[model samples]
Every structure is written in C-alpha cells, then in structure tokens.
Target chain A: MRWVDLVKVEARIAPLKAARPGDGRGSQSARVSVTETGGQLSRSSTGGVARLVAGGVWTIATADRLEPSIDEAVNTLRGTVEIDLGSIVQIDTAGAWLITRLERELSARGVSVSLVSASENARRLLEALAPAERDVPPPPETIGVVQELLEAVGRTMVRSWEDLKSGLGILGGVVRGLSIGLRHPRRMRFTSIIFHMEQTGLRAVPIIALMSFLIGAIIAQQSAYQLAYFGADIFVVDLVGILVLRELGVLLTAIMVAGRSGSAFTAEIGSMKMREEIDALSVIGLDPLHVLILPRLIALILVLPLLTFIADVCALAGGGMMSWAYLGLPPDTFITRLRDAVALNTLFVGLIKAPFMALIIGIVAAAEGLRVAGSAESLGTHTTSSVVKSIFMVIVVDGIFAMYFAAVRY
Target chain B: MRGAGKNPEEVIRGRGITVGFGDRLILDNLDIDVYRGEILGVVGASGTGKSVLLRTILGLQPMRAGEVEVLGVPYSDAAPAARSAVDRRLGVLFQHGALFSSLTVLQNVQVPMREHLRLSPRLMDELARLKIELVGLAPDAADKMPSELSGGMIKRAGLARALALDPDIVFLDEPTSGLDPIGAADFDALIETLRDTLGLTVFMVTHDLDSLYTACDRIAVLGDRRVLIEGTMGDMMAFNHPWVQQYFRGTRARRLGA
Candidate 1:
C-alpha cells in the first residue's frame, strides 16, 4: 500500500532484471497490460484503491497520438486516483505535461491524483516547464473595425503626402543639377547620358516602330469601313496621317515608355535604395541626382522626340499600305492625300509634347525609386505606384500641350 | 532524416551521409545521431556544410550515400505518404527569417495545419492565434505581413509557424544569430522551454557560442567533410582537434564563458 516505495521497488528490480539474462528492459511488467509504445492508460484496482497505470513513451512525439486517450482515461477515473509510472521508461515535457493536465482534470472532478514511481529526469523536466506554462500570456487585442479603417486611411494619406514632398525635392534637385551641368559642360558625364539614351531610347525603337505600325494599320482599316458608306474612303489616308502625326503617335509612344522605362527606373532606384547603395554613394561624396537621375532624365528627354518621329513614320507607312489594301487606292495616291491633309506645325506640336512627357515619366519613376524603403514589399509598391503616377502625369502634360497649341493657333 | 532505425539513444541517425555538388564533396561518409529530447547543436565554420547536413537529414538535399531515420522511420525509403507523415511531425526554422512576405502572420502559422487538417476556419483561427502567442508574438502581429515585422519579430513569427503543428522535432538554424545579446538569450530560453514543455528533440545548426553553452545539451562539430567530433561542451574543450580547440577556447569562446 506504500506507493512511495515503488521507486525503491524499481531500483531493487533493476539487479533482479539483470539477473534474468533477457530482462534488459527492466521491470516492464504491467498490471493491466497497456501494450502501446506511444502511450496507454489503464485502470487498475488493488485492495479497493482505484489506480491508473501509465506506460510507453509519453513525450511530445506521442502527445498528439496519446492526448485523446489520456483525456478519455481521465474522464473515466473517479474519486482518488493513484497514477503509477513504474512502467514508463521514457517521459518528455509533453508527457510530463499530460500527466500534470490529467492531475488537474482529476482534481476538477473532486478526485485527487498522485504520481508514483516516476523517473527523476521526468520529475525535473516537469518542474522546469511547469512554472512558465501558467504564464503563457493572452494574445494582444485588436482594435475596433472602425478604428482600423481610420488608421489605414490615415497611414495611406501620410504616405502619399510624403511621396509628393519627395517627388518635388527630387525634381528641384534635378533642375539644380541640370543648371550646374549647363554651366560646367566639360564636367558633365556625356558617356553616362549616351548609355541611358541607348537604354531608354535607342533600345525602345524597334518595339515602338512595330507597335505604331500596327496601330496605324488598324486605324486606317477601321476608318475605311465607316468612310466607304459616305464615299469619303480616300480621306482614310488623311485621317490616319493627321492622327498619327499629331496625337496618337506621341501619346502611344509616351504610354509605352512609361510602361517600360519608367518601371525599370523605379526598380533600379528602389533596389539601390533597399541595398543602401544610394546612401553609400552619398558617403563617398557623390550626388546621386547629378550622377544618376540627371543622365536618365536628359537621355529620356532627348530620345522621346526621336522615338515619336519613328512612330509617326512607321504609322504613316502602315496607313498608306492599309489605304491601298482596304480603299482600293494605290500607295502613291495615299501618300499624296496624307501630305495635303497634315500640316508641318501639327507635327511640331506633337513633337513638342514628347520631351515634357518623357521628363514626367522619368522624374516620377526615379523619385519613387529613391523613396523606396528597406523591405521587398516597399520596392514592389513603389514600382507599381511609380508607373501609374508617371503615366497619369504624361497624359496630363500632353493635354496641357494640346491646350497651349490650340489657344495659340500654332 | 535518412539514417534508418532508432537506437536507444538516437532519434535522428545519419550514417555515412555523403553529399556533393558536381565534383566537390561537401559531407563525405558523415556519421551522426541526435539523441531524443536533447538540444543537439551542430557547429562548424561557415561553408563547412552544416546547413547542407541539416538539409540532407530533412531530405531537402540529396544524399550520395547513407540513410537517416527520424521518429523511428527511414526517411528516404518510405512511401510519400509515410515520408509526409513524418514530415508533419517535424518542423524547420530558417536562420534568415524567410516568412512569406505577402501572407499575414496568422495565415503563415495556419499553413501547415490547413494543409494537413481539414479543421473549420474558426478552429484554425483559434489554433493559429494560440501558436503566435506561444512564440511570444503580439496578437496584433497576426494581422501584419512579414514585411511589417521587425527583424526579431520576424524570427519569432517564423518560430510560431514552425511550432504550429506541435512537432516532435524542430530544426533551428542559427536562431539567435542576428538578435542582440538580450534578445538572443531570451530566444535560447524559449527554445529550452519549448523542448521541456513539448518534449521536442531539437537539431540546431549554429555559430553562437552562447547558444552552444547555454542551450545545447550536446555539441557536434562538422569539419573535414564529416562530423569531426560529437560530445558535451566539456568534451569539446578537452578535445585535441586544432579547429575545435581554437573554436572552444578562442577569445570569443572565452567571452561566452566557455
């Protein structure tokens, strides 16, 4: 009846187990035969004393598997429960925890549970983990939905305001850098400007040309279908030529450049910011605006008009070819009608908008890039916002130019 | 884990594990075993294939030879079902805090549970929140993406996801590397508490000497294309191996009270 003596009994059984040549596992004899190695709880009654026997590896490895069974057994127990660990060869913190949880459960049922013949290691591990387990703090509370929405709105407003300020700062710095370079022309980085030109301009040529060509062909074809009913089919050449030379040519090219070069600039600047490369450049006494942004902006400004011209020529050729195919007019006849309908000043007006639009796209992209924070998510958000903002700015600039030319009758 | 069968002392056993890329042999005929319910720290100089060894045991990297057994099952030879079942019982913590940048902290912790269990959304939410709190993260962190969390917070959130499944073995890769001294000590203590409370067997790859002395129950050194030595801290200090001697008795080691 002295359950405290079970540890002594286990110690005593060790030599006896050794005496039996095949008893290497030592004193594994079970009272109720719970055979599972993961864990098993069995009921036993010795001389009217109700008891529970725990056997097998009662550790975290077996926690998920053994937890339900432990719960079930704890539920079935009544009154005072004496838990025997004499058969438990291995027990971990989870196993010890389960035993403790069972004890608590039993106590709740008005039944006191006592552990018997537990290993010293299990006792120590349980003791180490027990004190801290009760202090597992509750999760932090979330604010109300209304507060969260307000907070989000406030954060976005603050971020956008900061973005706007940074954009102005960068634009002012670019202007100052441009003025400084203008005064000291020999000191300016011509090679860097040319490289950026190749990147933002020269390289954009083929795609722009092909895209413009397709647009012109589509416009001429679509115009021919409607105009044939009015017997103004030959005027398809005039419409395609004027639209391509004046508005569609530069507007489409600017949009494409905004998509391509603007995004690339943002990503490049954003990554540089993320890596602290921009900071490193400053530490070395280099002005990033003068060294980096100026070249890109200038190159974009220089090449956009050239790209627009290329788009206009390709589009006119496409319109001429489509006029011959769809309106049954010869190529020479289409060319002659195009020349008569479009004026030189219209071409000049569209070309005049290109540099300003390019400037907007480059400045917005570079500014967003410079604004990028340390996270990959920040880089991505800035890149997307950069393209969107610049494309918007480009269209606005084009609209202003259109108004300026219309009011002047130029 | 590729090594087969569990010895009385072994929970993770790797025998003659040979890993190489192209012609360069990284770990050649390596033999090591992680005892059950102990924090076994695997230490080596950088580029010594310590991570590679851990990867090989987890079956992330291919082994040219040798086998490993984890939780008493052969990892490589087991059927996909059996392997994944074993995988469910294990978790890995990366050193660089590679939490998915897009997902909220709660969603990250729920990833494994959602994949393996068809628990209801409310239940999953409760369980995921419990895990985040268990790792000592703020509850508000559950709604925040990985990008929003600070460096230490990211690691703790990553730990929450690793412990979501209540795994038996959690492999920690330099858990305390980037943390400040106090933060590192707190992290080490957390690892110990989880081990004691959960009965987890930890296999950690680390260069932190404080972790080696305070957290790890046993230390295994990887060098010369295999496990150079495996023993307690005392054994490491007493060993005659040149690199081990320099590592354990170095100036940095002295600062760690080694």
Candidate 2:
C-alpha cells in the first residue's frame, strides 16, 4: 500500500479505536490482517477451462480488496470460466454488483461465464442488481480552458444584459405605481411603508452612527499626523469636514444599507416567489410591484436621505472630538474651521446621491428576488447577488457623480 | 396489540417509549416491533406523533424514556462501535426528500459508502447507479442536482440514497404523500419490489390508503399515544376503534372498495 493508503487506513481505524478502547476485537493491526484474509479467490486453469473459487465475506467492506483480482481474472481468463460461490459466507449489493459486472464483462468478450454452487441468497442479490447492466449515459463533458473562459464571458454578458433590462422594467413599474398612488393617495400602503421604515431606517440608526463616527475619527487622526509635519495641524478639521460631508458619510451609509436592507429585500421577496406567493397575488388581481415593491422602494428613498443627514452630523461630531484631543485644536476652533471649509452645497452633494443609491439598491434587490426559481439555493444565490450588484452600482454611481462635480467645478 | 416480549425475527424492537416536548407528552410508554422481511406500515392522524415515533426509533429524536434494540443489539445505549454497527444496518428516508442540495443524486448515494467503507470510486459509482435504478429513477438522474428533480423524482432519489448501504431495515416517512395517484401507486409498487428482491424490512409511516392496502404486509395504527392495533389489513378493518374504523373504511378507502 502507498503512504496515502496507509493514512486512509489509519483514519478508518482511529474511530473504531476510540469507540472501543478495551475491546479485544478492536485491535487495529489485527483487524487489517483479518479483512485481508477474510475474502479469498483462487483460479486454476486446465486447457481452456478456468475454475474460479470464491469464499468468505464478500460485502462492501471487503470489496476494495476483492475488486482488483476480479478485474484481473476477467482480463486474463479466456474460453469458459466457472465461478464457484459454494463457500461464500456473506454478500451484499456491492459484492453482488462486482460479481454481476464481472460476469457481464466476460460474456461481452465472448467468454462463456457460468455460476455454480451458489447459495439462494447470493443469487437473489445478483438478480436484484442485474438491471445495472443497462447502459448509463456518461457525465456531461467539460470544455477546454480557453473555451470555458469564452463561455463564461458570454454567459456573464448575457446575464448583465438581462439585468439591465429588468432594472429598467422595475423602474418603469415603480414609476407607474407612483403615478397611480399620486392620483389616489388612499390606495398607497402607508402602513407597510411605516413598517418598512422602522425595519430599514429606525432600527439601523445606532450601527450607522457608530460606523460613521469611527471613520470620521480615523480620517481626523491620520490627517492631523500628516499636517503636523508642516506645522498646519489645524487643517485636519477642514479635511474631516469636507470628506465626511461630501463623500464618506453617504457612501458608507449606502454600502451598509446595501448589505443590510438590500439583502433582506431579496431574501423576503425571493422566498415569496419560491413558494408561488407572487403568483398567488397575481392570480388574485393584485400587482406585486404596487403592493410589494412599491412600499419597500418608497421607504428606502424616504429614509436614506434622513439617515444620510444623521450620519453627517454624527461624523462631524466625531471629527470635532478627534481634532480637539489629537491635535490640541479646541472645539471652538475646530467648529470655526469646519464652517469656513464647507458650504451648504457640500452637504447637499452627498445627500443628493442618497435617493439615487437607494433606488439602485431597491431595483436590483427586487429584480433579483423576482428572478428566483423554486429552490432554497436559488433564493440564497439571488440574495447574495442583490447585495453585491447593489454595492457595485452604488460605488459606480458615486464615481459618476464625482466626475460630474469635478467637470462642472462644483 | 402484540406482546412486548423479544422475538428473534424482530429486526427493530422498542419498549416503553416515552417522548415529549415541553409539558406535552407525545408518546407514552409505546411498544413497537418491526420484523424481518415485512413491510410494516405505521399510520395515525396528523400531529399524533407518528413521525415522532419514527424519529425516536431512528435515534434522531431523544425519547424521554425508552430502549430500542435493532438487529438484536441495544441501539440507544450501545457502545459507539456497536451503535454504528446497528446504524449501518438501517436506512431512513425523511419526508420532503432531504437530499443534500449541493450534491448530485449520484454523490448523495455515495455519501454513506464514502464515510463507512473503503471502496474505489468506480465501484461506488456503479453501486450508486444500481441503487438509483432499483428505486426506479432514470439513469440520467444520477448527474442531476436535487433542485433539478421534481417531487416524485426527489422521493425516488432519496430512496436510492437510503438504500446505498444495502441496509437491512429501511425507514420511510410519508413516502408517497405528494405524488399523484398513478405516481403514488408506482412508488408503492417500487417499494414492494425492492422489499421482495433485497429482503428489506420496511418501516414506513404513511397516510396513503392505497399504499397501506397494496404494499404493506402488516399495518400498525397509532392512537391514544400508543399502538391501538397491529395486524393485516383485514385486522385493521375489524378493529373496534372509531378513528381506525373511519380511517380504514373512510370515503377514500371506500373508493378503493375496502
């Protein structure tokens, strides 16, 4: 046996040893030799007739050792071969499958194989496994590496096209729902909107506030250290003020919300789709976009800006505290510097991106959820991609806004 | 009910089983026995602990108080080796066809063989294919994941995995619950054929009256927290209990001319 086989034997015996520590039969070396000697096959050839004698346990546990000899016998033996099973003490499906496969292989090679002195139980097992002789189709072939790469690239391109179409479709449906709701305010699901606001906005306050605060303080300390080299440590207040209000606050908040509420939306709607609840609603003449997707979208759009405003305030407060402690800049001086560095448009630039980010997250999540098939695994996959696609789109939209602001010199 | 004494032919013997959740007792001092080479059907009303009994016997559920001996070994309290020895001889098919979602039907059937025995992958594949065919699944189903299968195919694949080890006793929970009438009958016939060829002792929990009539050799009715009656289909018809009377001779049973 190879080293790997020895390791496998040790792993197999370890559990048996732990299970029965003091039992005499549980001796590891003793059991290995016993298994080897339990099953025996001897072939004697006279002229063109080969008599193959088999004995002892022929179950699955001993099949690994017995299979090679059987294969060799099938390859070398020609003419008529008689397999004697008279001394076989035990057998199972695995053992029977082996014997049946051997007989079939020999017969296919035009060697007449006959079974003699077999017990009734062995015959029954062999008959039960005889249907396995029917040809089974081979597993699907895999493409070569270059072709596989091309296939993947094509699949991803088609998938992204489908995604873009669905995103536009959902946006149009939401717009239609908004128009109908505007015409008849009473038709809007205000209670559902409120419930979702509490779930996605109100419950997320503490974590979002804490995250913004930590990020603000880290930026303050790092900038102060760099500015202290030039004896301009007070400029850390301006860096913290502009960066937090213009970019980090809303971007971080959108990323967090994408991970949190965006994935939740996909999971909830995907499970409903999996169970055919969406179909049930359609059959009942209720639009899923109007009832399900509309409330979530509106709640996200309304709450994201409010959350962004709160995140900005918390981040500014954290920067103020960090400037005071780390740079010895008093709170009053830090406030004056922040006021001088940022104007009204600075905060609005960040808040303006909030609703657009929310829209992207909602549309992607709802689209993925609606695409779910009837499996828990599919629901999980869609939920994962909802978060991933929304986060990626959020960053991409932020980059577009950045480039637009820089070009127009805002 | 039959006496609770041990019998040599009994493959599974449970005595004085008591199982419960919280303050509610589900099974109270229940005694059950499964004989070798017999298709024993266990039936009861919904939430009457029929599945709970099956789980308890399989050692998946913890019984409040009981002792179960499988293959003449005390399964519940045996040494780990002895318990695993008993476990290797038993197979269980859960309701909902709980094949591992990530594995193909072939790999699902190979799981037990991989864990317990040292066999080549080629032989394992052939044996798994044999089992899949034995359970009446199409040959091509070997490569399909559990998600790709329909309701009936899932049950058949689950049965194939259960029979992977060539177990002596097979436990089935609601084996034919979701299939159409023709599909359910086909599954029942498949179970009967497997039991005949493999000499498998089937312990099936079912609600399908046709299956109980056509496939089972003996029927056990669980009611009032214990087996109310156990015998042939004729014995179930002659039993005096109201629930048993309505169940075996109900409108659906009447459609089958019971």
Candidate 3:
C-alpha cells in the first residue's frame, strides 16, 4: 500500500483495534491481501487463492482480473467465512451480474457476503448482489422508555431555575447596557429618539385608541346594567373613569406595546446577534450597545407616555359616549367628575410608570435579543420571553405603585 | 495575477498571537503576516485556530499573549476614534451574510458609508447599487430582504456589503465552501477580477483547494499551532511537508484539480 493509504487505513481501523479481544483472537480475525499476476484463473490459480487465505477470512483486492477464480471460490464455500466484494476498485456490469449470481447461490445455502463500503463505481455494480428472498437481520429495536423518561426530566429541568438563571443573565445584560447608555447620553442621539418614537409610538396610536375606546364602552355598558337596577345608572360615569384611569389605561397600553414593539425589539436584535452583525459593529469600532440598544430604549421611553396618554383620552371619550346613552349624564358633568376623581397623584403615578415600563420593555427585548445564541427558534423563544417578561414586570411595577398610592390615600 | 514585485511589506504582522477561551488556548503563539495586495488563503483541519486568527486581526478577539499591527497601526494602539479610522480601511464577510433584515439590500450595503463617510443618500445608493452589480446580483436584488435570497446569493450579497466602503483590505472566511463547483469557480473569478481591478488585499480562510489554486496569490497552510507553510501552490506541492503533501494529494483535491 502507498504510505498515504496506510495512514488512512490505520486511522479508520483504530477504533476497531480497541474493540479487539485480547485473548489472542486477533490471530483469528480476517485479513485482506492484494496480489498482482498476469495469469487468468481457471484451475491453475487455485494455489494462488490458497496463499491469500492467511487468516480466518480472506479478501482478495483486485481490479477486473480474478473474477473467474473468485466466482469458483464462492461456489465452493457457502457458509465458512464472509466474502467481501464491496472493496473492489473496479468492475464490469457482467462481472457484477456474476457476483449477484454467486450472492444468490451462497445466500440460498445460508452464507452471507460482505457488500458496500466500496468506491462509488464498485458499489453501483454490487447494488444487485443481494437475493430477492434473502433474509437480513433486523436492526436492533430502540427502548424509547429510557429516552422518553430522560426527555421528560430534561424538559422539566430546562424550565426550572436554570432557565430563570439564563433569564436573569439576559436581564443583567440589559440593565448593564442601559446603565451605560444613561451615563453617556450622547450614545443615544436625540434625533434617533424622535425617529423611534414616531415609528413605534406615533404609529401605534390608532390601535391603542381603538382598543381603549372598546374597553371603555364595554365597562360603561356593563356598569349601566348594575346601576340601572338600583335606579342610579349615572354612577357608571364615575365607575368607567376611575377604572380606566387607575388601572386599564396604563396597564393595557403597556401590555399591547410589550406584545407589539417589545417582541419586535427582541426579534430585531436577536436576528442581529444570530447573524453577527452586532459583532461587525464592534469590529468596526462602534459600540453595538450604544448604536442599537440606546436608540431603542430612548424611543420606547418617549413613546410609551404619549401612547398611554392617548389611550386615557380615548377610553374617557368612549365612556362619555356610553354614559350619555344610558345614564342621561351630560358630557360636561362626566368630564368634571373624571377631572376630580382621577387625582393628580393618580395621573402622576401612571405617567411615572410609563418611562419605567418603557425601560423594562426595551431592556427586556434587547436583552432577550442579545441572549440569542443559535437558530431562528431561539429568536422566536426570546421574543415570546421578552413580551411575557416585560408585561409581567410592568404589572408588578404597577402593583407596587398601586399599593403605595393606596397607603397615601388612606 | 502577481502584483508588481516589491519588498512584500506586511500589511498585517501578528507576533506570537495567543487566544484563549477560559483556560483552553484556542491559538498558541501563532505568528502570521498578510502582505499588501496579496490574497492569502489559510487552510487547516477543523477548529485549528483559523477563525481565531481572523478575529484577532480584526480586534474582535483580545489576544492573551501577542501584538498585532494592521496597516502600520497597532491593533490596540488607538482609542475609539483612531480605531474607527483604522477600521474604515478594512471589511469583513462572515460565514453568514449578516445583513440587517430590517434594511433593504442597498441599505445593508450602504451602512459602512453611512457611518464613516459624509456621502449623500443618493450617492450612497448609487455606490451600493454599483457594488451589488459588481457582485453579479441583479439591480432588483438591491431592495430585497436577506431572507429572499438563496445561500450563494447571500454570500454574494455579503461580499457586496463588505465592499461597501471600498476598503483597501477584505477578509472572507470560507467564501466558497458551500457552493457547487460552477458557483465556486464563478466566485473565484469574481475575486480575481476584484483583486486586479480594485488592488484590494484579501485574507481568505478556506479549505477549498480549487480556490487556493485559482484565487490565492499565496497559501498559508495552518497547522501545529501556527502556519506550517506559506508559499505558492507549486511551491507547496514541491515542499516535503507531510500535511501539505497530504492536502495537495487528497482524493478530493485531485478531483478539484481535475
């Protein structure tokens, strides 16, 4: 063999050597030999074939030369040893037909022939070497109970504290990134802030307005039924105003933006991370945290307040319309009551929460995006996580505000 | 394809470059040089510090024990502004296209110019379109998202983006590994044309032998923790290095040569 060929063979057979039995069964193992001769085999070459049988099983490596003698040998021995025809470097179709015939003859007598593992041309020739009714051993069946059990436990473990740890790591990255932005306000341009607000906040107006209007109308209509029973339907005006301003207005708007732009932030940045465009920015001596994260955070911060304020206006308008229809209360009276019932603190609480919620959404989304490591699936998962986490954080923050406000009121 | 012979002044000179991930050294005392206006192809077995070298040169990776000079500026000598100034002279095409999905192909190509050059939007668009055309993409492709393109098309689009600023140097990591023979040959021809026309220096990391022979002015065979041999393909074949011989005489190499 050539030196390169010897290296290739040794590299391939290294694992097989480790599997060998150490009790000297190595002597019984099959051996491969290649010999060249000018003589064609009919009967005189039987001794040459004998010289090749140096071990338990012998394989003759030849190229279009020893077909006749090899054919005769196949006919002579049916079950004593495995015959490997797969390694033939070359063959004619007629030779392949003869090999197939020998394969069928031997298989009928309960012997197996070594096939495949040859060069493409030889493998094509050996394709029909298997008999039509030959019985091949079935593949070992897999015990899926262990796999299923392991998968179940694996999934359970993945969803537990480890997942939370990753989530917190992402959260920490967001906070760290945002803190840097705050320290270097120049990192976030005022123009990009305006642009982002126009895109994410101003563009989101119609949806938020429509949603708040429907919610207010629904609340007014529901309260009208209960108030009418007590001959006090006018109270629906007070109910709708207080409920929307105190809770639904800020909460629902944040949730909507969380689902909408928050997830967008996550997906946009996540895809950027996946594609290494973020790395490209760093390589170009631009801080990706500043260029990407800052503008987004600023935009979200500026937009959330305006969106919340619009949602508040629309909800009150819808409630005013419904109150006029059912409660016979004048628009001016309802407006006055809304102005009085929603204390300055309540309005301040909502407005104050807006920037914090924006920061939360922006950080959560960008953090999730940054955490994306692999395929598109990770992006989807992170987007979902960003929305869920931002909304949850928003609600929790709002709840804290509510408690503080209640304590001050009482 | 050989440039007017000069002293081969090094455009990038890396000395004893060492990179580590935690405790494991990915690259150990690796020294390399990329010459001006030369196409250097780096080949190695998998995970043999090929990409680490590329990153270290770009300053994206911090070398634990080494110094590197790119275009006469030490990689870490500059702060942000100076670093960006040095960076403006270079471009990178990663394995994936890494295009900004929200931006159009034209916009993706225009990013470097937008950041560094004070060019007009109309002018940037014109230049970006020119680059896109130069990379053999259709004019209509200039507006499409990255998702709309095929794998080979994405690589070409990435090439267009890398050429956006008309940088003097370019780095392509595995530019043709996934392409069919015809596609790969087309890519090689494109690189050759760019090298001749633009006088750009290229550092290409690849195992594709056809690319090494057809495009690289010199090949750097990376092994044994550093470059084992750096020479022309003919020189590489003549050399008695076992890895080089094995690589040049491989079955796939023979088929590629044929």
Candidate 4:
C-alpha cells in the first residue's frame, strides 16, 4: 500500500514539473514561474534597444521570483528599453512598484524607459504609485558582538542606578503613606489590607506548610544518615531544630511569598499603570502609594512573620516524625533535644528577618509595577523582574543578617 | 437579498448567519452579500451586531447556522491550505488598529508580507515604506512603535498593513472612529483611492456618515438582529423604516444634502 501511494504521489508531481518548465534552481538569468498565472519576464536586446515583455499575474505572491529578474534587467540592460505590459493579466502595488522601480533605475542610468501597452487597471496602479517611488531608508545597523556586550553592561549599570533611585523613592512614599494613615486613622484602608492578607497569607498556608514539611523531612533523613557514622544520630534533632528556627524556615517562606504574593502585587499594579489608572488616581488627588501600595505592603509585612512561625512549627513537626520513623527516636525525645539545642533568641533572629524580607519584596514589587509603561509586554517584563529582584534581595538580606549575628557573637 | 438586475459577483456572501453569545442572540438569520469592486459600508445603532456580522464573515466568530463564502470559497469548511490561500487574499483592520505593540509600524506592515511571500529584505523594506507613504503616514513614523503612535497614525499604520499583501478584499472595523475630522476625511479618500487603483473590495463597518455619503458605493443598515435595508444612498433616503429614516435623514446626516 505504501509503495502504491509513493507511485501515485510521483505520478502527481511529474506533470507539475513539466507544466512549469521555467522552474529552475538558482539561475540568475532564468525566468522563474510559480503558479499557472505567475509573473513571467523575458528580455531581448537588438540594435542598442532592450525590449522586455512582462506577463502573467504580477502581484506580491509572484514578486519574490519576479524581483531578481527585474534587478538583472536593470543592471544588464543598457540604452533604451521598452517594457511591454499588454500580456500582463494583473498588477498590484507590489508589481507596479517593481515596474516603477525598473523604470526609475533605467532612467537614472541615462537609458530612456518607456512603458508600452499597459492595460487600464495596470495603468491606473502605475500612475498611483508614481509618487511613491522614494528611496527606503535602510534598516538600523546591527552592532558587533563586543559592542553589544559592552552596551549591555553599560545599560545594566544605568538600569541598576535607576532601580536604586526608584527603590528609595518607593520606600519614602511608603513611609509617607504610613504617616498619613497614622495621622488620619479613618483613611487607613483596613478592608483592603485584610483582603490582601487573606489573598497572600491565608490562601498560601497549605502550600507553604507542605513545602516546609517536605524540606524538613529531607534534611532530617540526610543529617541522620551522616550523623549515624559517628554514633551521633541523636544530633540530627538539634541540627533540624536550629536550622529550621534560624534560617531555613524564614528564608524558604520569604522566597515562596516573593514568588507568590510579590508577583501578584507587581501584575496588579502594573496593569493599573498600563491602563493610565495610576495617572487617573493622581489627578483625583489620591496618592497611589497610599491607595494601592500601602495596603499590600502592610499586609505583606504583617503576614510574613506569622507565615514564618507557621513554617517553623510545621518543619519541626516533620523533623520529629522523620526522626521517630527513620532513626527510632520518639517524638518526646526529639522535642527535648530541640528545646535544649535552640534558644528563644534563635527563633527571634529568624522572625526578625521576616519583616525586613517582606519590606524588600513589597518595595521591589511595587516599584517595578509603578515603572510599567503603556504596553502589556512591559507589564510582563516588570512582573518577572519584580519576582527575581525580590528573591535576590531576600537572599542578600538573609546573608547580611547571618553576618551581623556572627560579628556580634549573638 | 439579491439585487434587482445585472448580477454582480459576490466577493462575500453570508447566508442565514446566526450568531449569538450564550443565549443572547446578536445576529439572527442574517443574510448579506458584498459585491466585488465595491465599498460596502455597514452601519447600525450601537450593539446591533455590526462588528459581529463582520467577524462572522471573516470566520473569526462562529455562526450557529448557515455559512459564509469569501472569494467564492467557504473557507471555514475548506482544507487548511485552501483556508490559508483565501486568508492570504483577505486583509482585516480591526477597530482599535490592533498593531502589534512590541513591533514598530514598519515591522507590522512587513508581518503579512513576510509570512506569505519570499521577497528579499530590501524589497520588503521598500514595499513596506511605499505602503506607509501610500497611507499618508510620515516616513519617519515607520520606526515608531504602536504605543508611540497617535490614534490617527495607528489607524493609518493598520491600513498600511492591511494593504500590505495587495489583498483582494479589505475588511475595516470602525476605521475612522478615533480620528479627527480631517484625518477621517483623508482616510476615506485613501480607502476610495485604494479601491479605485487596486480594484479592492472593501467591507467597511463604520459610523461615519461622511464616509457613507461620499465614499461608500452601497450601504447596509443592520437592525433587529438582521439587515433592515441594503441599497444605494438614494434608496436609503426613500426607505420608510424609522431607524433608517432617522439614520439617513438625521440632523447629522442632513448636513450632506441629497
């Protein structure tokens, strides 16, 4: 059956080739044919006169194949040229532009060009396109790889400077908004803050708890496996407790919140900016920082520490379960070890980083959002940057906290 | 509805085109035919489904009953290659100028040409520039993004893209809605000139009475989920329907004398 289909396909294609005899591969002078009514061009020179006959459906579809022939005619044809348009069945702007271009190029070369026997429709199009025969400006030049790289580096530096300025501006605006809310407690948008809190915090509990629990179990199993070699299997509980309380709990929770709530903040505010709603708010004498960013920022700052506490507890529970199941240490023994290993300060250090992380996330997201231009693409770009910049800042702030605690010997 | 005599070739034929969103019927059993080489202006009161009918004929919206034949092909039911062949021969300019926001006007015009034809980049540039100039946009406006263009310039840029392929038919949705009077008049003149020079069949959904009076060869008024009247300006004036009477003989339309 396959062999029969192949034979039939060949039988179909054989006549197409025969019917289109002008079809040739990469011939500069050869006249190419497309469809049955595709554009056809032929050149003949006799006694210092070149007579070119153009025929068939001369539109944009055939312009690609017809263009090279016209160029070849322009470059090679010398002296007077007569272009016969009698046989041309149809001509659109593209075709007319080609003929007009050929005429202009020949005239520029001191060769008298005459368009003869053009049909009424063809004549109208040619006359219409006569004024449109101006030189097209060349496309923008592409720079070399080295120059592009250097330019990108320079752009990144400038962009970073702008980001810093905008970040500080947002922080100041947030402070001003907070002061306004403090002075007029009635102006505080408590409903909006609660809405954002519900959206970003309450809805996020299950996913955040599940993620932290899995991390805690994995860490316990790995640590117990390593500690057992030295007959120090009981030390895994101390490791899990201190790590979850001081670093992993807050860091993982902040990163997750940045991915979740931070991107949402950027997208929401960015779409408002894109639609000129931000400008509308400003014109209405309402500071967008107060009306829009304040509620979201307050909610994030209030929620991050609470979420971190939840994450810590879930992680500790996961570690206790893992120890009991894998290392044969019971939950009470694990709890006793955790209490002995980690102090109140250890938990405080982690909880203290949460608000600062929240502030960074909120500021970056809001700043990026407000920077969105009048395009959906710009909104997407800013939303993505908001997530990336907040995550990077979260890690950097965590590292700084770690260094500060180490330096003070806290 | 068929014409009285002298049968003209129908470039677009919509038969019993029933379109609705959920249970709300916008166009019910509507039939419309647009002849070749004619500017057919479709007008109606707001929410009468003028744009819906246009979308139906273009196959952008699904019709619950009947079919549309464009350029003698029922493209919705046609094979993929056949559909694209018909699609290449048709051009559409949406109400909002619908230029790709990320691309410049020049690149937007080149998009259709690039997809269908295998022209050289230089030829594409020149053709695109010619189109831009033909639509009366400033040469420098070619490099500006859609966001940077004014409302009138965006419409012109969109028209340039629509005419990019030298399509057999051009469908324009509210082409002059956002333009100033002078710009709207210029656009109407441009559309008329394009039709004359390129022999293009234009299906224009417009509210501009000036365009209907001066540029459109025939007008189709949509009403009550179907076409109420489809005829010349003279026939429109004589039609006794209340909406038709108000539309053609309204105060705004009365400024242009019969």
DockQ of each: 0.18, 0.29, 0.02, 0.36
- Kindly indicate the candidate among 1 and 2 with the higher DockQ: 2
Indicate the residue-level lDDT of A279 in model 2: 94
Residues A1-410, model 1: lDDT tens digits: 11111122112122221111011111232112111244567787887668888775564434555567677877787877898987766565446667877777788788877889876656665565444333333657889999999999999999889877877888899899888989999868899999999998989999999999999999999999999999988889888977888899999999999999999999998898877798999999999888889898999999999999999999988887888887778987777777788888878888988998988888899989988876688889989999899888888887887788789988
Model 1, span B73-145: residue lDDT tens: 7886778866776787688899877787667888899898777654446445755766676678776778897
Question: lDDT for every model?
Answer: 0.78, 0.85, 0.70, 0.86
Using lDDT, rank the candidates from best to worst: 4, 2, 1, 3
Better of 3 and 4 by DockQ: 4
Which structure is stronger by lDDT: 3 or 4?
Answer: 4
Best model number under DockQ: 4
Scored against the true structure, residue A19 in model 1 reaches a CA lDDT of: 12
- Flag regions of model 3 displaced more than 4 Å: A1-185, B1-258
Q: TM-scores of all models?
A: 0.74, 0.91, 0.45, 0.92
- Per-residue CA lDDT of candidate 3, range A1-410, in tens? 11112122212122221111111111222211211112122221243222112111111111123345555666676443444443232233323434555556666667664442444534443452322223222424767998989988999788656556755665565577668768986764778778778878988999999999999988998999998999878678778877887778989999999998999888988989978899999999987777787788878987898898899889989999888887777899988877766676666666777888888788778778888865566677888888898899899988998898789872
Give a tens-digit lDDT track for model 2, residues A1-410: 22113222212221221111011111222111212224557788878789998876566766788889889998988899999987666677777787888898899899999999877778877777765755656767978999999999999999999999999999999999999999999999999999999999999999999999888888998898899999998889888989999999999999999999999999999999978899999999999999899999999999999999989999988888888898788988888888899999999999999999999999999999999986677888999999999999999999999999999888
DockQ score for model 2 = 0.29
What total of clashing residue pairs does each candidate reach? 5, 0, 0, 0
lDDT, candidate 4, B31-130, per-residue tens: 8998767889999999999999988888889889988888778855777766776787788999999898888999999998888767899889999999
* TM-score of model 4 (CA atoms): 0.92
Better of 1 and 3 by TM-score: 1
RMSD of 2: 5.5
